[model samples]
Structure formats: structure tokens, C-alpha cells
Target: MLTKTKAYALKGLEGQAVEIEVDLTPGVPAMEMVGLPDAVVKESKDRVRSAIINSGFDYPIKRITINFAPAETKKEGAIFDLPVAIGILSAYDQIPTNCQDGYVLLGELSLDGSLRKINGLMAILISGLQNGYKKYIVPKENQAEASFVDGIEVYPASNLSEVVNHLSNVSPIPRLETKKFNGKNETSKYGVDFADVKGQLKAKRALEIAVAGGHNVLMVGPPGAGKTMLAKCVLTIMPDLSFEEAVEVTKIHSVAGVLDASQGIVTSRPFRSPHHSITVPALIGGDRRAKPGEVSLAHNGVLFLDEVPEYGRTVLDSLRQPLEDGVVTISRVLQTVEYPACFTLIGSMNPCPCGNYGSKNKECTCSPSQIRNYIGRISGPFLDRIDIQIEVDGISFGEFKDKASGEPSEKIRERVVKVREIERERFKGSKTRTNSEMTNEDIKKYCEVDRESQNLLELSFAKLGLSARAGFRILRVARTIADLEGSDSIKVEHIAEAIQYRSLDKKYWK
Candidate 1:
């Protein structure tokens, strides 16, 4: 007898349908698997067998063969264990074949016959729904995450017996109740807030603009300055995640196996601060499993690299492509997978090895050669990508002891949300979301400046020796500043303020 069961496979963030086919014949007792399965999938045969026998079922000891259809695509993980076991049981007439039809099975089977929760269930179920698969049999442990997905009948099974009983109509498992998606149900607090930081109002203002326009920022300061604190406070002032953004972020986190399954969704904007010793693949996404790296994991959020100059030049340079394209593609011998990496970059760096090369209150000890070499670690081209670069000076004693708190993050977030709404209305029915994501065409169409602003920008470009990319970034930032002030056109003052952010390259890099 031959039987088939439906399953799903994950490749990067997308899921593909896989048909688990089982064939049993009255011959020698042996079992074999085919269809480009990985070692984990191949090992599922023993697990499936043990689970079936241990679950009070007769194991088919005859010649058995299993294949994952669409053999060209490589199948990985133990997501197929339940489906393979079901196919075998259905083929042997132990369970009605009609029960296995029209359902997608996804879980890992233990020797004790219990169903273990698997990663990427959210991605798989969402993809299956889009492909017109309605019903699913998932592990009970995944119920919370599965509940977030609507328009489908999800049967949460604790073990193979429960599923079999439910399918046989002896005892039917209740379908999971769908939960409504509320992106802002969870509070948007990150413990650290801008009000806690005593000074460096300029740095705080720059961070607000960076988060408002989704532009990259680089902060230069001496040791003990509030650069790191300012960067950490960025999440507090960021706009709330839309339902679509939350879903996209949740899918990536689910596939990476880093999601908090209890929450069933990610509402807060992600803040990923990788160490300086990170490798290229670790930051850019490529390993044996081709999992998502820090960039992809930081999708729709902030990717902060503290002490940026302490990082390897190569690793820092590796981010150029993803920074420009907003997506990282990891290629293997057989396939290439792309993960969305649209994130705001926040980098903090010291002026020199001594951390006081250009501080007004501190004396510098590093020589010119040493300062040049230290700053040289960050390439000019890489600095060009950053839209805002501000120097964070040491706070004065009077300012630190004033006991007056700065503006709260809640107020900053209100302005950010309003600015983001304006962008959304401007980019309606399109993919562009923020000023940083605008292309040259978008810049020409929306970022036009008056004669005085244009001439000022041209003069600044000539005097500062700015690259074309740098000039365009300044224009993008100016557009964001105008949007913040509710101005219809980019004003000369906005252009001047945006130009001030680019002066650090001349001050430090020279």
C-alpha cells in the first residue's frame, strides 16, 4: 500500500510544501528514505519507528520506503517525523487515510511518542496559509505561537496517540482559538530612557532624528560619555511596530529560533548589539545551517556596534552591501537564501586609543600618526553611509548636578510616530518607508530643495570633499528634518543643520 501526507519545509524565511510519501510491500524487513534529505531528516526514521511502537501501535516490519517529494530541494530538520509516521500507519491501514488528507503535519517525535515543538512553525504555518493550506497538526508546545495565526484550524497535539485518536474520531482535539494581533499591547519601555541621561542634548537630538527617519548614526565621544546610553534609549523613542512589521520580525525571529514563544509575537523594536569580535558570517548570516545573523535578526530595528573602531576592518566593511541593499543573501553550493536586514545602524566610537584625541576638557596623549591609524580602522566609504555623525562631549559638572531630567522618551516617540505617519502617507502603496530607504529617484521626486539650500549644499559638498553618496545622504537627512518641523519643502536651516552632521568626517578622519 502507498500513502502520502502533507508537510512543510523551511528555507531561510520562506516555507515550501513537502509531500511525505510512504510505500510498504510484503517483502524483506527494511526501511529507507530518499529525496535529498539531510542527516537529521534521515535520522527521523528511527525516531518515527520508536514513537510508533512506543505509542501502542504495530510497527510495519515489512519493506518500507519514504520520499519527500520535490526531490530537487534539500530537506532539513525533523519537521517531517510526524508526517512520515502518519504515512506509514495510514499505509498499513492502522489509521484511516482519509484522516491524514488535507492537513499539514509539523513536529519532532521523541522515542516516548511525545511531540516536541519545532522552530519555524510560525513561518511554516503562515506560508502554508498563503498557499491555501487551512488545517494543521502542530505540537502542543507551539499552541501559543500558532494561535496568533488566524483563518486556519490548528490542532495542537501532545502525542501521536492524541492525533491518531482525533483523526479516528474517537477523541477530537479542539482547534486553537485565534488570537487578535495587537502590536502595541505590550508596553514600549526599555528600562533606560533619555530622561535618565543628564546631558549631551545634541546627541539625544541626533538620535531622535536617526530613529525618526530610520537613518544610520555614528557617535564619537570620549570615555564615560553617554554614547552607549543614548544608543540604548533609541528603542524607547522608536515608533510602534505596525502589524505587518511585527509579523515580518516575528517570522525572522522564529526561523532563527530566538523568539520568546510565549509572546507569540514580537512587539518591541529589536536592539542587537554584537561584540566587536564578531566574524563576517556571524554578522552577515552564513553558517552550516545558513541561519540568520545579527543583521537579519535586527530586521526593522537597530543594529548597534559599540566601540566601532575596535572591530575588525574587514567585518565592518562586510556590512556595506546589506547596508546599501537592506537585505543579506547567503549563497551555498546548492542554493542562496536572502534575509531582510532593513535596520537602523547605531555605532559609537572613541576619538583615539586614549579616548581623548579631540576633547575640549581633556588632554590628548596620542600622536598624530597613532590617531590617524586608529581612526583609519573606520574607512571613509563606510563613514559615508552614516547619515548623522555627532560628537558627544563630556558633561559639565553643573549640568550633571542640576537634578533636572531631560525630556521623556514618550514625548519623543510621539513626534517620531507622527513623522513616520507622514512618511507612510507620502509613500502609500509603495515599499519606501523612511528617508533612508529613498533611492535617487525618490530623492529627486520628493527631496527637492530651494535655490539657496541647493547652492549651500553644493558649496558644502565642494568644501568638505563629500562623495555623491554623502551628498545624497545629507539630502535625505534634510528631508527628514523638514518633515519633523511640518515643513512642505526642505528649508535652508534644515539643510544647514543636516550639513553639520557630516563635519565629523573632516574633523576626525582628516
Candidate 2:
């Protein structure tokens, strides 16, 4: 007897359909799994064997051959365990073969016949739905993840026996209700607020512009200048994630096995702070399985790198491509995968090795060469990508002891949300949601400058020795500053403030 069941496989965020083919014939009792399976898929044969007998179903005593169609593509996970088991029972006449049709089966079966949750369930279901397949049998633990995907009949089962009974019409399983994507309640409120920071009004203004435009920022300061604290508060003023953004984030987290099972969906913008010593693969996304790195995980959110100069030269330079393209491509011998890496980068570093290069109260101890080499750790091209650069100074003793707090994040977020709304109206039919994402054509169209601003920019370009890339970045930042003030066009002051952000490399990197 021959039985065929349907399953799904993932390559990055994309999914491909796989057909599980089970064949039974009279011979010595044994099982074989074929079709380019990896370690996890190859071991499913043993798991399926134990699950069938433990579920109170008679184990087939005939030679069983299970094949995954599309033999050239590699299968990588234990998600095929349930489908292979169901195919065996159907081929042996335990359950009607017709019952498994039109339904996608996905889950990992334990030795005791209970089902376990697997990663990337949301992506598989979305892929199946897009390909005109609907009804699904998934693990009960994954019911929350499946609930968010609409237009599908999802039957979540607990153990192998429940799935067997459902197929046999003995006891039918209940289908999960469709869940609506909620964006309002999904935003997380952190314990630290922007109002907790004291002094550094200039640094606060720079961060406001950064968040309003979705631009990258680099802060140079002493050890206790509150640079890291400012980075944490950026999220508080960030606009909430929309429904579509949340789904994209959820899919990445689900595939990476980092999604909280209870949350079902990611509600807030992600804030990932990876250590500086991270390797290239771990920071950019590659391993034996080619999973997503920290960049992809921070998609649609912030990637905060504290002490930016402490990172290796290779690691810092690897971010150039992803920062420019907004995507990272991982290529393996068998397959290639692309993960979304669109994010706002906020990096911080001290002035020099002694952290007092430009301090007002403390004298510099490090030699000129040591300070030069320390700042040189961050390459020129890497620094060019950062739009806003500011120096944060240590607060005075009286300023720290003052009772007054800085502007709250809620107030800053109100202005930010308003700026984003204006941007939304400006780029209604386009893919860009912020000023930093504007292309060359977008700059010519929306980022137009007045005659005065144009001459000012030209003079700054000549005197500052700025690259063409730096000039475009200045225009983008000026455009964002204009948007924050509800101006119709870029003014001279906007261009001047924007030019100020680009002159930091001369002070530090040079």
C-alpha cells in the first residue's frame, strides 16, 4: 500500500512544500527515510516508530519506505515526524487514506506519542495558505502562534492518539479560532524611562531627531556620561509597530526559536543589544543551519552596539552591506537564504582609551597615537553610514543632585508620532517609511532645498571635505529636521544642524 501526506519546509523566511510518501511491502520489518534529510529529519524514523506503538496503534511489520519528494532539496528539522507517522498508519489501513488529504500535518512526536512545539510554524502555515492549502494539524503548544493566521482551519492536537482519532472520526479535534492582530497592547513598557536621565540636552535633541527619522546615531563620551542609558530610552519614544511589521518580526523570531510561546505575536519594536566581541557569523547570521543573526533579529527595530570601537574590525565592517541593502544573504553549498535586516543602529563609544580625551574636568592621559588608533578601530566607511554623531559630556555634581528630570519619553514620542504621520502622507504609495530610507530619486523629489540651503551645503561640502555619501546623508537628516518642525521645505538652519552631525569624524577619527 502507498500513502502520501503533505508537509512544509523552510529556507530562511520562505517555505517550500514537501510531500511525504510512505510505501509498505511484505518483507523484513524495517524503515528507511530518504530524500536528502539532515540529522534531525533522518532521526525522525526512530521517533515515529516509538510514537506509533505507544499511541496504541499496531506497528507495521512490513518493510516501510518513506520518501520526501523533491529529492534534491535538503530537509532540516524534526517537523516531519507527525506526517511520516500518519502516512504509515494510513498505508496500513489503520486510518482511511482519504482523511489525511487536504490537510497539512506538521509537528514533532515524542517517544511517548505526545506532540511537541516546533519552530517556524507560522511561516509554514502562511506558505501553505498562499499555495491554496488550508486545513492543518499542528501541535497544541503551537495553537497560540496559529491563531494569529486567518483563513485556515487549524486543528491543534495534543498527542498522536488525538490525531489518529480525529482522522478516524472517533473523537474530532476542535479547530482554533482566528485571532486578530492587536498592535495597541503589544507595545512593551520598559522600566527605564527617558525622564530618568539628567542633563545632556544636546544629546537628547540628537536622539529625538534620530528616532524621528529612523536614522543611525553614534555617541562619543566619557564612561559615566549616560550614553547607554540614552540608547535604552530611544525605544520608549519609538513609534509602535504596525500589524504588518509585527507579523514580519514574529516570523523571524519564530524561525529563530526565540519567540515567547505565551505571547503569540511580537507587539513592540525589538531592541537587540549584542556584545561587542560577537563573531561575524553570530552577528550577521550563519551556523550549521544558517539561522538569522542579531541583525535580522533586530529587524523593524533598533540594533544597539555599546562601545562601538571595542568590536573587531571585521565585525564592524560586515555591517556595511546589510546597513546599505537592508538585508543579509547567507549562502551555503546547498542553498542560499536572505533575511531582513532593516533596523536603526545606535552605537556608543568613549573618547579614547582613558575615556577623557575631550573632558572638561579631567586631563587626557593617553598619548596621541593611542587615541588615534582607538578611534581608527571604526573604519571610515562604517562611520560614514552613521547619520548623527554627538559628543556627550559628564554632568556636573549639582546637575545630578537637582530635583528636576528631563523631558519624558511620552512627550517626545508624541512629536515623533506626528512626524511619522506626516511622512506616511508623503510616501503613501512607496516602500519608505522614514527619511533615512529615501533613495536618490526620493531625495530629488521630496528632499528639495531652498537656494540658501543649497549654497550652504555646497560650501560645507567643499570646506569639510565630505564625500558624496555624506552630502546625501546631510540632505536626508535636514529633510527629517524639516519634517519635525512641520516645514514645507528644507531651510538654511536645517542644513546647518545636519552639517554639524557630519563633522565629528574630523574631531575624533582624524
Candidate 3:
């Protein structure tokens, strides 16, 4: 007898259909698995046999063959265990062969016949839905997250026997009740707020603009100048995630195996702060399985790097391509995978070796050579990609002791949400959502400045010796500033504020 069961394997962030073909014939009592399955899939036979026997079913002592069809895509993980076992049981007529004709089976079965939770279940289910497979049989442990995927009849089963019962109609497993996705995710509650920070109004404003326009930011300051605090407060001022954007963010997190099983979806934006010692592969996403790294994990959110100059130059430089393209592609010998990395890069570093090069109250202690070498660790090309580079001076004694809190993040987020709405209307039906993502064609079409603003841009390029790319960046930021002020055109003040951000490159890196 031959039987087939439907299953799914993760291909990057999307799901690809996989068919489990199980064949049984009268011969020696041996079982073999074919198709391009990894070592884990090859080992599922033992677990499946033990599960079937333990679940009060007969494990056929006959020649058995299981194939994860297509025979090309590399299949990893134990997501195939339940499907393989189901196919085997169907071959013996223990369960109706047609029961799994319309369902995607996903789970890992233990020797005791209990089903355990598997990774990438959400990714597989969502991809299956998009590809027009609306029914799924997932592990009961993953029922919460599975409930959020609408239009899918998800049957959550506890073990192999329960699944077999559901298939046989002796005891049908109840379908999971779908949960409504709220905009605010209750899993990750953030207590940090902008009002908690003491000072650095300029840095706070820069961060607001960075989040408002999805631009990258770099903060130069002495130690304890609130740069890190400002970076952490960025999410507080960011706009709320839309449903579509939330799905994209959740899909990436799910495939990365970091999704909160209890929570249905990810509503809050991500904030990934990798250590300075991170490797290129770890930061940019590369491994034996080609899993998503920090950049992809921080999709639609912030990638903060504290003490940016202390990071490895190679690792810092590796981010240039992902920052420019907003996606990281990891290629292997057989398959290539891509993960979305559209994140805001916010980095903070000191002025010099002594960390007081440009301090107002303190004198500089580092020499020019030390300063140059320290800043040199951050490459010129990397700095060019950052749209806002502002200096964060330490707070004065009077300002620190005033006991007056700055503006709350809630108020700042209102302006940010309004500006984001403007961009959404402007870029409707297109992929361009923010100012930093605009191409030269977009810049010419939407980021036009008047004569005075153009003169300021040109003078900055000539006097500061800025690159042509720098000119485009300044315009993008200026357009963001204009949008914030409800101005139809880029004003000179917007141009000046945007150029002021670029002045740090000449100030420190010169």
C-alpha cells in the first residue's frame, strides 16, 4: 500500500510544500528513508516506530520506505516526524488514508507518542495559507500562535493517538478558536521612556527624526552622556505597527525560532543591540542552516550599537550592503535564502580615546592621532550610510538637577505617527515607505528644494568636502524635516538642520 501526507518545510521566511510518501510492502522488516532529508529526518524512523507502538497501534514488521518528496530541497528539523508516522499508519489502514488529503501535518513525536512543539510552525502555517493551503494539524503546544493565523482550520493535537482519533472520527479534535491580533503586543512591555532621560534635547530630537523617516543615526558623545538611553527610547517614539507590517515582522521572528509561543503575533517593533565582538556571519545572517541573524531579527525596528567605534571594522563594514538594500541574502552550495533587514541603525560612540574630545566642561586628553585612529575603525562608507550624525554633550549640573522631565515619548510618538501616515499616503501602492529608502529617482521626484536650500546643500558639499551620496542623504533628511513641520517644500531651516547632522563627519573623522 502507498500513502501520501502533506507537510511544509521552511524556505527562508516562506513555506514550501513537501509531500511525505510512505510505502509498505511484504518483505524483510526494514525501514528506509529517501529524498534530500537531513540527519534529523533520517533519525525520525526510530521515533516514529516507537511512537506508533507506544500509542497502542501495530508497528508493521515489513519493508517500509518514506520519502520527503521533491528530493532536492534540504530538509532539516524534526517537523517531518508526525507526517512520516501518519503516512506509515495509513499504509496499515489504521487510519483513513484520505483523512490528511487537505491538511498540513507538523509536529515532532516523542517515543512516548506525545507531540512536542516545533520551531517555525508559524512561518510554515502562514506560508501555507498564502500558497492556498488553509488547513493544518499543528502541535497543541503551538495552538496560541496558530490561532492568530486567520482563515486556517488548525487542529491542535496532543499526541499521536489523539491525532489518529481525530482522523478516524472516533474523537475529533476541536479546531482552535482564532484570536484577534491587537496592535499592541502584550508579551514585551517596555518601561523605559524618553521622560526618564535627563537631558540631551538635540540627541532626542535626532532620534525622533530617525524613527520618523526610518533613517540611520550615529551619536558622538562623552561617557554617560545619555546616548544609550536615547537609543533605547527610540522605540517609544516609533509609530505603531500595521497589521501587514506586523505579519512580516512576526514571520521573520517565527522562522528565527524566537517567536513567543504564548503570544499570537509580534506587535511591538524590534530592538537588536549586538555586541561589538559579533562576527560577520552572525550579524549578517549565515550558518549551516542559514538562519536569520541580528539584522534580519531587527526587521522593521532599531539595530543599536553602543560604543560603535569599539566594534570590529569588518563586522561594521559588513552591514553596508544590508543597510543599502534592506535585505540580506545568504547563499549556500545548494540553496539561497534571503531575510528582510529593513532596520534603523542607531550607534553611539565617544569623541576620542579619553571620551572627552569635544566635551564642553571637560578638556580633551587624547592626541589627534589617537582620535583619528579610533574614529577610523568606523569606515567612511559606513558613516556615509548614516543619515543623522549628531553630537551628544553631557548634561550641565543645573540641567541635571532641575527636576523637570523632558517631553514624554507618547507625545513624540504622535508626531511620528502623523509623519508616517504622510509617507504611507505618498508611497501608497509602492515599496518606498520611508525617506531613507528613496532612490535617486525618488529624491528628484519628491525631495526638491528651493534655491536657498539648494545653495546650502551645494555649499556643504564644497566646503565640507562631502560626497555626492552625502548630498542625497542631506536631502532625504531635509525632506523628513519638512514633513515634520507640515511644510510642502524643503525649507532652508530644514536644509540647515539636515546639514548640521553631517557636520560631525568633518568634525571627528577629519
- Give the TM-score of each candidate: 0.97, 0.97, 0.97
Q: List the residue pairs that clash in candidate 2.
A: none
lDDT of 2 by residue, 169-216 (tens): 899998899887766522246777778888888888899999999899
Tens-digit lDDT track of model 3 for 1-510: 999999888878867889989999999999888875557755787899899999999999899988877777647748888988999999989898678788899999999999998877777887888899988899998898888888889999999999999888899999899987777522235778888888778888888898889899999989988888888888888877778778888888877788887886887889999998899888998887888999998998889999998888888888987898899999976579999999999999998989999899888888899988988888766897899999999899999998989898888888988888889888888889998888898899898888988788888888898888888999999989999998879899999999989998688666
lDDT order of candidates, top first:
2, 1, 3
TM-score of 3: 0.97
- Model 3 ranges with Cα > 4 A deviation: 185-188
Give the least accurate 10-residue stretch of model 1, judged by summed lDDT.
181-190
What are the per-residue Cα lDDT tens digits for candidate 1 across 314-426? Answer: 99998988898889999976678999999999999999999987788898899998988988899855786799999998899999898989998888888888889889898
Q: Is candidate 1 or candidate 3 better by lDDT?
A: 1
Work out candidate 1's RMSD over C-alphas.
Answer: 1.6
The TM-score, computed over Cα atoms with residue i paired to residue i, of candidate 2 is: 0.97
lDDT of 3 at 279: 90
